[model samples]
Target: MNSCKVIDEVVNKGLCIGCGLCVSACGNNNLKMALNEHGFLEPQQVSGHCEGCKGACLSVCPFNSKPNNDISTETKLANIFINESKNHNTSIGKYINTYAGFSNEHRVNSSSGGIATYTLIELLARKEIEYVISVKETITTDSHYAYSISSTRDELLAGAKTRYYPVTLAGVFEKIKELDGKFGIVGVPCFIKSVRLAQKADPILETKIRFLVGIICGGVKSTFFTEYLASKAGVDVAEYRKPEFRLKDETSTASDYSFGCLDKDNNQKTIKMRMVGDMWGTGLFKSNACDFCDDVTVELADISLGDAWIEPYRSEGLGTNVIITRSILADDIIKKGIENNALTIDNLPISSLIESQRGGFNHRHNGLGFRIKKRRSEGLAVPPKRFEKDELSFLLKLIHLMRMKVRKKSLEIWKKTKSAEQFDKRMKPYLFLLSTLTKINHYYKWYSEPGAIKASLIRKKSKIFK
Candidate 1:
């Protein structure tokens, strides 16, 4: 690894695909991708995770757009689909024939499925909700965060794609007064809690809200990852203008990506950045904030969406989704839409979802694995005495580390192939060195601070006391 590698700027308001290449790269046990509030897996920083490695993680990030302050969003299309689905379609308001890429695409490009996003878009089109209460990208001096708030279709679509940043409903609650009227939302479990709190705080919202959609995220990132990326892309952090993650794509996979921005010269620059097996789970492309998160399934929301990590669909390009309807009203809308030929429907299970999607908190967060390790350390768990003859642990650790490095290196090579070959070649080594010293909170670093830590222990303690 180069010692003088360049580090990217902090990313505040976007998603991380959670691929885990960085974890593979680090010979030292400093980096890991863990679950966040929403359930999706993300990069985390263990105290000693980074062995002064830089290029491995930073080079692999696909979302880091040029940071800009002049960013903005507004509403787009708003047309109703009366009855435009098929026999397989289940609900009128639940699916959209108007949109080419909707209707149970859950078998295709999504996490759990395509239903939740479709649901949100349908409500917006029907004008049932004036704005989708969601997280829009935010720019802070240090980095950008996907601050929670209300969003129009244009805004939501613009903000689409995974943003590995921490999102909270508290911010969205503050923005709700301006939206005022029937509204929908897309968020994680914690965000749903915040929304419930907001509704409790205001009686009108209880009436005004028409729908709620939650994403099954593993964790969120800090703004530091964003800034670090921008800096590496030859974009100046001080003169940064705006940042956009997952700049729209017909292809849902992370591999087919294009970056866009107006450079310091006010000239627009777009870059095609794509690779194989690109998903948010890559540890190389995540935020440190993820490790602290505890929720993954989005229990508080009426509906939740994610990718269906199943075989046939997972093989079909990367831009698909999965959806789960938990609320009666949500189920009604989807069901009605399907019956009216406005959408399609399907019955599914939680396990099927976990296996198909990337890292969510349910089975993906390493919760089970962590428990196993903890038990093993405590002597509550043990290897077979016959197997104890060999220290398989060291071999397993070595394999994991080496694999991560190979993946990280492969990604770096892929990126340079698209950019200036010579320039990127020279820069990669330097950037590798820089990425070592350069640490970010969201995409690459994992945190252990007690301030934002989530705990089941607290709940258990309260129950025990009771």
Candidate 2:
């Protein structure tokens, strides 16, 4: 079978994130994004269409690792915002200012303070963009949500809340070609980066896309993630409809939210995410591409939004958003919102914004380094990352390895057994080992601290006995 470079380099290596930029970038229409056996979207090559191809798909692929063909996210941001942005950092990238707050109007229905939704709406209201391209629920049963074009306030509002399930941009890119107006897109870091990469390779996209709004993401889950959750919640997967990944309870804190889904009969079932247990941190069902990604703040985006997963905001049931504004226009819209009382926000120190996503940074930064090193040691190809491979402690290495195993095997085990119990049983040994190592590393660091008085006391007592 003939294949595109993307298939041989990314998809075959398990690094495809299903962003679908490859499908949209294929000038010959040689590729189509389809759901694979693992329930993640990937580009499938059409026979005979790749003849004399110029490799546009590989050029735009986020996971593409072709030597000297790679365009780093940092370079992309500098090319666009070097003079516009006031600050830059390795972790958060370029930014004019960082803020922590939420839209007064959008917080109720939003997953996290509605900052992203509010920003997209304001950009439309201000006539900055002709349309907003974002993920929204579809009427069809084949997929719950897909990327859509929305120009109206109600349309944008209907697309609110977090969607953990996988989605691709193949459809929206096609729509962008048919539509004749400027557009703004909302996406996660990897998706936003892919769009930027596409724009560089395709002049048409560069002219049409006006703004990029980014979501601070840990990783995306496969469709099986939803099925597993629904199955555990006693909702019939066959009838699962209108699944809402984040449903807030006024009595509880922002992070303490529930997952809600509707049955065929329209009955809604709700379950707290905590009840689902440690799926996010444990990397269950996460795309392997996520393990290779290092961009946490969507550095290429004009502005980025994330759940303020810290402090008083965490305790606030209404939800809060941590934002990083990298473009002047994005900053202006936010400042105008503050002036009009449309938003209630505070200027956040960059440190505070970074702290809000400390776990994400640890994984993308430290954990990523370990994974790259391990892959290279095995003589396997790995995607190019911003940070170099790190020499990690043995325990840290074990923790990272266990995470990689969980992400890879979750889908495999689910595909075979389709039973959450079996999945959990198979995962127990990995989880148990990980948990033990984590505790040991934690205490070891604590006792190794310079002022660990308990350590000092123990040493003194032992010396006296000797």
Best by lDDT: 2
TM-score of each: 0.49, 0.94
Evaluate residue 287 in candidate 2 and report its C-alpha lDDT on the 0 to 100 scale.
Answer: 89
* Model 1, C-alpha of 327: deviation from truth (Å): 0.8
For model 1, residues 4-82, the per-residue Cα lDDT tens digits are 1112221222234343333433445455555444333455666622345634444333222221112100000001111
True-vs-predicted CA distance for residue 440, candidate 2, Å: 2.1
lDDT of 1 at 330: 62
Worst 10 residues of 2 by lDDT: 457-466
Question: lDDT of each model, Cα atoms only?
Answer: 0.43, 0.83
Task: Estimate candidate 2's alpha-carbon lDDT, on a 0 to 1 scale.
Answer: 0.83
Backbone clashes (count) for model 1: 117
Off by over 4 Å in 2: 67-70, 81-83, 450-466
